[model samples]
Target: MNGLSPSRRRARELVEPQHWVSGATESVAGLCQFVLLLRLGATLMLVVAAVLIEPDPRTLLLGTLVAGTVTAAELAVLVRHPVAVVRWPVFVLVELVAGAAIAGLMEGGPVFFSFSCGSAAVFGVAAGLRAWPVWVVQTVAAYAVVAWIIRADDVPATLAVYLTGVPTLYVLVGLASATARAAVIRHVNLARSALEAIERSAVAAERTRVARELHDSVEKTLRGLSFAATSLPQAVQQRPQLAAELARTVAEGARTAADEARELLGMLRADDLDASLAQAIERACQEWAVRTGLRADTDLADVEAALPVRHEVLRIVREALGNVARHSGAAHAWIDLVREGSTLRLTIRDDGHGFTVPGDLNHLSAAGHYGVVGMAERARQIGGRLRVFSGDDLGAVGGTQVVLWAPAGAMAPMSDRVRT
Candidate 1:
C-alpha cells in the first residue's frame, strides 16, 4: 500500500476510490447538468456584480441586457435536445466568444476569466453529443480560443496561468468524450444482439410446436396402418369366412398414406440408454423357476431408465425374453441396467438351456421378431452396439446376457441424470 491511507488517497483523486470508473462516468453526466445550470445562475451574478462595480449607468445597463440575453439562450439549450445536436461544436465556439466578450466588458476587469464557466459547458456538450466531427471542431476551436486569449490581453503572469496550462483540461475533455461515445456504442450493440437472440428462440419454438402437431396427426395414422397390416394374417387364420374384411385393410392403408404425405410437408418446412451389468450369474434363478414351475424372483430395475429411447426398446426386451421363453425353456428373467462411464450397459440374462448365438442377423426378421430387428437398428442409429452371449460348454457364465453398449451423446447425459 502507499504511505497514505486508502481513504485519504481516494479523496485526493477528486472521485472516490471504489467503483471509480463507473462513479466518474455518472459524475460526468451530473456535472454537465450542474455546470449548465451554474452558468445560467453565474451569469445573473456577473450582471449584478458589473452593475455594482461600474460607475457609468449606460455601461451597466448594456452589460446587464447582454448577460440576460445569453442566459436565456443557454437555458433553452439546457432544457431541449436540439435538431442541431450535431452543430454543438459551432455553438460551443459561439458561447466561448460570448463569454470572453462578457468578461472583457466587466468593470471588475476579469478579461478571459468567464471562459472557465462556459468552457465546462462546451466540454459537456462534446461528451453528450454522438455526432462525429463535432468534438474535433470543438477541440480545435478551444485551442484557438486559448491562443487568442493569451495574445489578446496584457495581464500579470500568475493571472495569465491558464494560457499555458489549460491543455490539461482539453486532454481530460477529449478522454471523457471518447469514453462516453464508446459506452453508448456498446449499449446499442448489446441491445441489437439481445433482440436477434430472442427472435431466433421464438422461431425455433414455433417450429417444434408445428412438428409435434404433425407427428400426432400423421404418425398415429401410419402406426394404425402398420398394426392393421400385421393383423391381416391372424384375422384370416381365424375368420376365413369373412373375405370382405380384407378390402377394409386396403382403405385403411390408403388413408394412412395420405395422412403421412401431408405430415412430410410439415417436417420439410422447419429446420432447426441402458444400463449395465449386474449380478451376472444370479439371474439364472429366475430362469430356473420358470422352467421348473417354481416361483420366479425378478428384482429388475430397468423399466423407467430406458423409456426415453422410446417404444422400440421396450419391444426389444420383450422379444429377447420371449425367445428364451419359447425355446430356451428359461425359468426366471432379470433385467439389469448399469452405467459404465459415458455408456449405458443393459444386460438381460436368463438361466436357461443356453443356445448358440444366432448366426443370421435376418433370422430374427424371418421369425417375425421385428421387435429385435427394430431395436438393433435403433441402437445402431443412436451410436450403440448390441451382442448376445450363450452356450454352456464354451462360456464361463452359463446363461445368456444380451449386453447393449450405447454412446450416449451429449444430450443423453443430462436426460439420463434426470431420469435416474
Candidate 2:
C-alpha cells in the first residue's frame, strides 16, 4: 500500500472494507440491519429445531447454549449498534468461534448446517468485501469443523459433499453483498454531485441577471439624473427659466431612478417568470404605451421559452421600450413577436428620429448607451443575436429597429406554454 502511487493509494483508501460501514449511506445501513434480522430469526428457529430433534440430551443442551449465547450477543451488540460488530476485531472472532462450535456440537445436522451458512452470510455482509481475509478465516474454520464431524460421526457420502460445498457460499454471498454496497454508494455520490452543480449554475445565472437588471434600469436612470443635476448650476445664474426646467428634470429623474430600483427589487422577490412569454410581452407593451402616451401596436405569435430565456427577453423588450420613451421623439411604436422556423424573432420599431447604428453594439456602454449594450448582452446570453437598424444605413425611413433572433434550443416546447 505504501509503495503505490498517490492516485492508486487514494483509490485503495476509498474501497477499504471498514469504510463500507463507517461511511454507510442510509440505504446501506438499512441493508445491514435487515440482514442481521434475518440471521437472528434463522438462528432462533434452527436452535429450537436442534433441541427437539437431538436424541442425546447433553449434546442438545450444549448446542442450544452456544446458539443462544451468540444470538444474545448479536442482539445486544450487532442489533443496537451494527457498526460495532464490524469495527471491533473481538466481535469478528466471536462470530467465527460461534459458527465452529455450532457446527461441531450439532454434528453437521441439516438444520444446524443451514444455520452455520446463514452465519457466514451475515458476517460477510457486515464485514464488507475489503475484509476478505476475515471471510477466508471463517470459511476455513467451517470446513475444518465439518471435516471433524464427518470423520467422528459416520456421516453419509452425500451429506459429506453437501457439508464441504456449503462453506463456499460464505465467499459468494460476501462478494455479492460487498459489490452491491459499492455500486449503491457510487450512484448516490454521483446524484449528490449533479444536484450541487445545478445549484451552482442557478446561483451564477441569478448573479448575472441582477447585474443586467442594474445596468438596464436603475443605472440608466441615475445617469440621466446625474446629467440633469450637473447642468442645473450653470442655468441658475444665466437663465432662471432654463434653471427651473433643469431642476424639475433632476427631481423627476431622482424619483424615476428610485422607482426603477424598487421595481427591480420587487421583481427579484416575485416568481413572475412562470407567465406566458407572448402574453407578458404584449402586456408590457400596453403598459408602456399608457405610461408614455405613445401609440404602441403589438403583433405577437404564440410562443414559449425556458424561464431564463423568457427573463432575458422581457428585460430586452423593456429596455428597448424605455429607449423609445426617452430618446425616440416618436409618436408611435410597433412591436412584433413571431417564430421563423427554428428561431424566435422579436422586433421593436419606433417612428422617432433615428441615431446611427454603431459598428460594434458592445461599445454602446462606453458611449453611455447602457440600455442598448444590455439588450445586446441579453440576446447573446439566450443563444441569440441582436441587430440594430437605424437611419438610411439599413433602409429605415426615420426610426430605430431593434431585432433579436433566438435559436430554438433556448426555447421550450409549444406544449409547455403557460397561460397568464
Candidate 3:
C-alpha cells in the first residue's frame, strides 16, 4: 500500500502541465490529444457507415479513399504541431476546409449528413475550449454549410437536424470544454499567487534577520567605541592609571566587535540552506546542549518545506533555545517538529524559571529582547504564528513553551497575527 501510494502520485504528476508541457508551444497538448482521439473515432465511424450504405460502392470507395488520405495527412500534422491549430483564424479555416471536403464527397446520404454534424460538433467544442471567439466563428460557418447541404435533399428533415442535433451537441460539448479549461486556468493562477506570496514572506524574514544580526554585533560594538573615545580625554587629565585602563578597554572592545562582525558575516554565508529542516534543528539542538550543559530531547518528524521557510523555522528554534540557555536556567529542554495535515507545528519547551510574556510582541523590542521579537518576525515571514506560553500563571512547574505553526507548503501569505 505504501509503495503503491508513491507510484500513484508519480502517475498523477506525469499529466500536470508543469511536468508534461513546460513550454507555451505545448501548452494545449493534453487538450489536443483528447480532441484528436475524438475526431479520429468520429471520422472512422462516418467513413465506415458511408461505405456500407452507398448504392455505387466502387465510386463511393474511391471518393472515401481520397478523403481518408487527406484527413490522415491533416490529422498527422494536427497531432505533431497542435499549437498551430489553436490559433483562432487557423483553427476555423482548417476545420471548415476539411469538413467541406468530407461533406462534399458524399453529398446527399444520411451518413454524410450525420458526419457533417459530428465534424461541426467536434470543431466547435475544441474551439470553445481553446478560445470562445473561435467557437462563435466556427458555429456561424458550420450553420451556413448545413443550410446549403439540406436545401438539395429533404428540406424539413435537414432543417430539423440543423435546428435540433447540431446546435444541441455543439453547445453541450462546448460548455463542458470551456468549464474544464477555466478550472485548469484558475488552479494554475492560484498556484502562481501562492508561490509569489511565499517569496515575499521569505524576503521580509531575511531582512529582519540581517537587521537583527547587525544591531547585535556591529551596532553594539560601535556604540561602545563612541562612548570610550568620548571619555578618553577626561580619563587622561584626571588620572594616568584610569587613562591606561580606559585605553586597554577601548582596544579590547574594538577587537571584540570586529571579531563579532566577522562571525556574523560567516554565519550569513553558511551553506545550511541545502540541509533538511529536521537535520538542521537536530544539529542546532546538539550544539545548544553541548554549550549550555542542558539536555535536549528532540522529536523531529520528516516534513517537506521550502528553503526560506526552513531557514526561518531553524532560526526560531535557535532563538527559543538561546532564551532557554541565557534566561530560563533550565536543566532540560524539549523540541518537537511534526507535520499536522496542512500545517507544520514546532514546539520547544524548557523546565526553567519562566518569565511573563507580554500581550504585545512589540513590547519585547522596546525591552531590548530582540531574540523574542526576531522569532516572531521569522514566524510572520513564513505565514506562520508564534505563541509564547509561560510564567507563574501556568499550571505546570516553572517552564516556558514556544510554539510556531506554519503552512505545510510554506506558500501562504504573511500572517496578520504576527506583530511587526
Candidate 4:
C-alpha cells in the first residue's frame, strides 16, 4: 500500500524473488516446457489449417508469414528472458495487435479465426496468475477489432465462444497450478530448515556428553598414571618396595584407562547416571593416594541430589583430585561434602603450591589447562556455581580450594538461581 501496488510487487517477486525464484524456476521447469511445446504444436496446426483453406491465397499467404514471424519473435523473447516471462503482457499485447491486423487482412475466414483461437490459448497460459487480465483484454480487443472489420453477423457464434471460453479456463488453471506449486515449495523449505536445526542440536548434545564422559573416566586414570610415572624413579633409589608399588599402580591405571575408553565408546547411546557422588569421590581419592603417596582426608555428610547433579558432582570431584595428583603436587588433599538447609556444598582443598587465581576463568583454556574450565561447565550444567581460590587467598601457606554450591533440588531452573 505504501509503495508499488500489490499486483506489481507480486509480478516482480515472481520474476526474481530471493531464493524463491530460483527454486520456483526449477519446480515449474517441466510444466513450462510442456506448455511451450503445446503452444508451438498449436501454432503448427493453425499454419496447416491456413494453407489448407483457399479463399484469397495472397492475403492468406501474407497472414501466414506474419503469424509465423510473430510466433518466432515471442518464442525468442521467452527463451532469452525466462525471468521476464511474468511480464508477458507487454510482448503479448504486441503479438495480439499484429495477430488482429493479420486477421483483418484475411477477411472473416476460417484460417484467421483458427489462428487467433490457438494464439489466445498460448497467451492465456503464459500470462499465468499475475497478468491474466492483460491476456483477457488483449484477446477481447483483438476479437472486437476483427469482428468490427468483418462485421459481427458474418463471424460465426462458435468462433466467439471458442475465443473466450478456452483462454479463460486455461488462464484460471495456470493461476491455480502456479499458486499450489509455490505453497508446496515453501512447505519443503520449512521442513528442511527444521531437520537441519534438529541435526545440529543432536550433534551439540553428543559433544557435551562425550566431554563429560572423558572427564569422569579416562582423564582420572591418566592423571593417576602420570603421578605414578613421575614418582617411580625417586622411590626406586630410596625405597625399592615403594618403586615396585608405583610400577604396579601405573600398569593398573593404564588398564583402567583402556577399559574406561571402551566403555565410553558404547556410552554414546546411554544417559544413565548411576554413580554415587560420595563413594565415587572416596574411590578417586584412594586411587590418587596410591599413585602419588599422598594423604586424602574425606569428610562426607549425607546429601540428596538428582541423578544428573550427582553424576556431575562425582565428575567434578574426580577432576579436582586428578588436578591435585598432576598439577598441584599437593602432599595432602581434603574433600568435604556437606548439606546446609536447602543447599549442598562440596569443597576440595589441596595443601600444595598454588598458582595465582585468574579473574577470567576462560584464560584456563587459553593456557592449555581445561580441568578447571571443564569443572565449571559441569557445575553450570547442574545449575550450580564453582569457585576456585588459590595463592594469597589461602593465607601465608598457599594452597588451592575449589568449592561447588548447588541447590538440593538439582532440577530447579538455572534462571531461578542468583548469578554472581
In order, candidate lDDTs are 0.51, 0.72, 0.66, 0.67
Per-candidate TM-scores read 0.34, 0.54, 0.50, 0.40
Top of the candidates by TM-score? 2
Report how far residue 315 has shifted in candidate 1, in Å: 29
Where is the poorest 10-residue window by lDDT in model 2?
Answer: 14-23
**Candidate 2's residue-wise lDDT over 1-420, tens digit each?**
679887545534543433432244344545655665676677667657766776665765666567666766665665565445334345466766776676666665644555555555555555556558876876787687678878888889998898788778777877877776667667766776787799999899889879978887788888888888888899899999999999988888788788778767755754355666777887778778888898888877767676687787877888899899998899999888777887889999999998988799877777767778878887888899999999886573779999999864344454544332
Rank order (by TM-score, best first): 2, 3, 4, 1
For model 4, the superposed segments whose C-alpha errors exceed 4 Å read 1-12, 15-22, 55-128, 149-420
lDDT of 1 by residue, 342-373 (tens): 66666667777786656755587665444355
* Residue 7 error, candidate 3, Å: 41
Model 1 spans with C-alpha error above 4 angstroms: 1-83, 87-157, 162-164, 216-420
lDDT of 4 by residue, 1-420 (tens): 249887657665654355543344433433444554555566567666766775656776677667667666666665665545565567567756776777677654544554555454454444445556654665565556545644655547776665445434434554555565556457656766788798998678667767868876689779979989999999999999999999998998798789668645633323333544555566666766887788889876656587567767876876788788779878889888777767789999988999887997879977757779878988998899999999987888678999999877532333332111
- Residue 145 lDDT in model 2? 69
Q: Weakest 10 consecutive residues, lDDT, candidate 4?
A: 411-420
Residue pairs with clashing backbones, model 3: none
